[model samples]
Every structure is written in structure tokens, then in C-alpha cells.
Target: SNLVYDWVKAAILFGVVNTVACLDHLDPPQPPKCITALYVFAETHFDRGINDWLCKYVYDHVGGEHSAVIPELAATVATFAITTLWLGPCDIVYLWSFLNCFGLNFELWVQKLAEWGPLARIEASLSVQMSRRVRALFGALNFWAIIMYNLVSLNSLEFTELVARRLLLTGFPQTTLAVLFVTYCGVQLVKERERTLALEEEQRQDKEKLE
Candidate 1:
């Protein structure tokens, strides 16, 4: 029903579902189907809108690449602000890229901007710088949110512990590798010490026997 209440609920659900899905696909230790489903939901539902804005706002800014801050922010802020301000029931604030959902190609934008006018160059440079910083900022926030959500949501199903255990398991191969290296070093050390001790004992016996 394009009703205000329904639209708001859909908007909120859309944000959560998309962010979770993106995070699930991030590589290495992944989440369950339920979690992955959220990602699918997000991409299918929201990506079109995002990509639409990408086509409109991003493609032109850096000459076919939405790599710079001006274009990236223009898209992110515009979409985010619009969703929050109008698309939902209540005013909710969230960054959609927190789930590793979006990546901006800053280098491409800069390369394209390399031959622009002074003002265009300045704007492009600043946008690139700002985009880098914003990426880091959103990443940190996403991590914090993940930690918080896992702590709360994993209790009944032990989902949090599962993730932690997976992290440990993923390290097992590397840890075993380091252990093997250390054991080799220890064995060499022991052999060297034994050789020195044996040589010393032999010298002492020779001296005593000679005397």
C-alpha cells in the first residue's frame, strides 16, 4: 500500500536487511543463511535505488567514475537523507555502507580529475580525501555495531561464540605453522647445547686422564 506507515517499516527493514547481507558476503568467516538472506534482500531491494542514484550523480562527477567525495557523498547523503527523512515511519539515522556494502574508486576519480579546471580539481581532490576518511569512519562504526549486535543477538543461539570460534579455527592453520617453526628452532638449540656440553666433558676427561 504506499501508505506512510508501511513505507517506513519497509525502509527500516530495507536498511537492516541490506547491511547484514553485505557483511555476510565479506569473505572468510561468514554468517548463516538468515544473515545472508538479509544481504540478498538489501541488494535486490535497495541496490536498484542506489545504482539509480549512482547513474545520475556518480557517473558525471569524475567523468564516468563515482570515485570522489563529492559524488560519493552526493549519492550516499542524498539517498540516506531521503530515506530517513521521507521514506520511513520515524526518523531513523543509519549508514548503509557500514556492512561493507559499497566501495568507492578514489584513484579512478582522481585520475579522471587530473586534467580538470582548478576548481574542479580542488573539489575532486577534497572529495577523494574525504571519501577515504569516510570509508574508515564507516568501517569502524560497522565493527562496533557488529560487536554490539553479536553480543546481544547470539546469546540464545550462541551465534556470537560461533563467530569467535570460527575466527580461532581460521587461525589454526597459521598457528600450527608458527608452532612448527618454533619447534624446529627449539630442536636446533637443544642440539647445539648438547654438542657444547659433550665437547666440554670430553676435554675435562682428557685433561684428567693425561694428569
Candidate 2:
């Protein structure tokens, strides 16, 4: 069914599955047949409905090199709103559209922030270990902001109540700082992994030359 809950679940599962599949692929290098088939298998077209195609088209072509026609961010969100309207004017549809639009923009925001000059300067002044820790700290702050932004779409009506309790009953600020200190570890790990792979490729080439 076209339930918002189902959409949220699918989005979460998509993240977990893609992360696991990517990490595992680096080691054993086996076909993640299960992942390949299930990445919204062709069967999923029935439910997923290729609804995102228009937004994608705008992102790719319309929002292309000549962006005066439509700014990229506005183009994506507008097309998505159009898609939601096409689906119908249900409350859940509107909520779903808002949440997904946030997700889309949140993705771009993160990328933009990563490329921002200040972040680069911060990293430059620090040791490699500290620089990565700083990035992850920033990443962790982003994670919570993201969770709060999408909480309604991901949960039941009680999401409002849940937010209330989180704010009222707990040391929310402290917990947030703790989460930041926990490290946004993913980026550092992926960077090191890629560096290792490159080194391995170089070693293989050297061996071939020696032979």
C-alpha cells in the first residue's frame, strides 16, 4: 500500500542495506545478490510507481548547466510537489512530500557544508585525527537535526508527543553534545578505506613490473 509509514520504513531499510552491502563488498567482494535484487526490484515499480522520475529529470536536464531557467534546489522541490499533487491531496501525501523534500535538501546541504571553506580551514589547522573527529562531530549534529526534521514522517501521530517528551523530560542538550563527540565516523572510515585500496592497487602494479 501507499502508506507513509511504509515509505519511511523503506527509506530506513534502504540506508541500512546499502551501507552493509557497500562495506561487505570491500572485503569478500562477493555479489550481494540479495541487495541487487532488492534495491527496489522491478517488482517494486508497482508500489514505488516511478514517481520520482520527474524530479530526477529536472535535476538532470532542466536544472542543468544553464540554471537560470530554474535553480537546482527549487527545481527538485517543485517537481516533487507536483508529483505529490498528482498522487492526491491527502494529508499523509503532503506530509510525505514535506519529509522527502527535507531529505533531498538535507542531502545537498550536507554536501555544500562539506565543501565550505571554513570546514576546510578547520581541518587544515588540525592533525588528521582531530580533523576527522571534527568532521564527524559536525556530522553527528547534522544527524539529529535530520532525525528531528523527519520524525513526523517516520513515526505515528504521537511523534509530536515524542518530541515534547524528548525536550521536556531529558537533558536534550547534553545528549546532543554526547552524540557529537561520538564521532561522525563514516566519512573518515570510507576515506581511509579508499586510500588503502589505492595503495593495494599500487603494490599490485609494482609486483607485475617486477615479474
Candidate 3:
């Protein structure tokens, strides 16, 4: 509905302003209390109810046989969500910038995903053997695009450019090292996959010879 769209738009604007302001504090886990506040605000004014998405995408995914993966996935989802609302447009400009900002963290977290749970280990091991086509399919970058849009879209509003310029002065330079480290983490994940596949093939052929 158009109303829904308008609400989303409003929520995005509010989120961007909030995020830029919070950059100075930058607390770990972003303080659950803060997130809760945003959730309430979005729900009340913007109609972006957390319950719907939380139930559909997040609820069923956590706390059970697959519980171990929950922490990592939840963290990733939170980071993704915050960036989406804060960045403001779900566009490419913010997407790349956000990635560069947290790419290293993402790379490490992705690696952590490979080890975080029984399911995670199985998935990572399978990924190592899976075809590049399958990998590409799973690598859908829309999540990233949304975050960028959120960030850049906010720039359309008053004072956004002023805030971004300030962020650039401090956040950008510091994040450079993080970016390089994350890039290295990505390479490590690739190498780890290759090693697993090579080992898997060796064992398969050995079994075949014996049988």
C-alpha cells in the first residue's frame, strides 16, 4: 500500500538521522536497549513492525537444534538491519561504503559461520565442494544494496552531507585497515574451502579404490 511505503520512507529518514548520531558512541552489540528503542519508534510512527519480520525470518531460525548458528546470524541480521535503516536508500553508494566500513568484520563473521554450529560446519564443508554457480546464487547482494540505499538515501535530507563529511574525516580512514583485514579473511575462506574439497576428493578416491 502507498501508506505502507510512506511509513517505510519516514522510518528510513529517522533511522539515518539516528545512526549518524550514534556513530560517536559506537558501543559493542550496539546496546540492546538502543535497538529496542528504535524498534518501538519504527513500529509506532513508521508502521515497520518488527514482529512481522522477526517472526518470519528470525524467530524460527534461532534457539534449538541449530541454536549455535543463531548468534552469528542474528548479529549479521542486526548489523544488516541497522545499516538498512540508517543508510536510508538501499542504494549502491551506501552499499559499497558500508561494506568497506565493515567488510573485514563481515569476512571474519562469515568465516565464523563456517565453524559456529553443526549445521554451519556442514554447510561450509559443502560449500567447499559446491559448484561456483551454486555459490554465486547464494551470494545475492541485495542485502548489501539495501544497506547502501538506506545510508545514501538519507543524504537527500538536510544536514546529511554535513554528517557524511564528518564521518569521512574519522570513520573512513580508520576503517581502511579493517577493510584490508577483512579482504584477507575472504581469501582465507576461499583457501579453506579449496583445502576441504581437495581432502574430500582424496578420501572419495581412496574409498573407491578399496571398494
lDDT of each: 0.43, 0.53, 0.44
Instruction: List residue ranges in candidate 2 displaced over 4 A.
Output: 1-55, 65-70, 99-103, 106-120, 167-169, 179-211
Q: Candidate 1: global Cα-lDDT?
A: 0.43
Worst 10 residues of 3 by lDDT: 31-40
1-211, model 2: which lDDT tens digit per residue?
2234455565666656657878777432222222111211111221332434563565455555423323656765676577677777777667766765655555556656766799767667899888767655655555444444445444654774576466546687886445445435543554466679999999999999999
- lDDT-wise, the better of 1 and 2 is 2
Best by lDDT: 2
Tell me the TM-score of model 3.
0.24
Model 3 over residues 24-70: C-alpha lDDT tens digits?
76432221221111211112123234434543465334422323444
Candidates ranked, most accurate by TM-score first: 2, 1, 3
Report RMSD (Å) for each prediction in the order shown: 23.6, 9.0, 17.4
In angstroms, the error of model 3 at 207 is: 66
What would the TM-score be for candidate 2 when compared with the true structure?
A: 0.50
- Model 2: how far is 146 from its true place, Å? 3.2
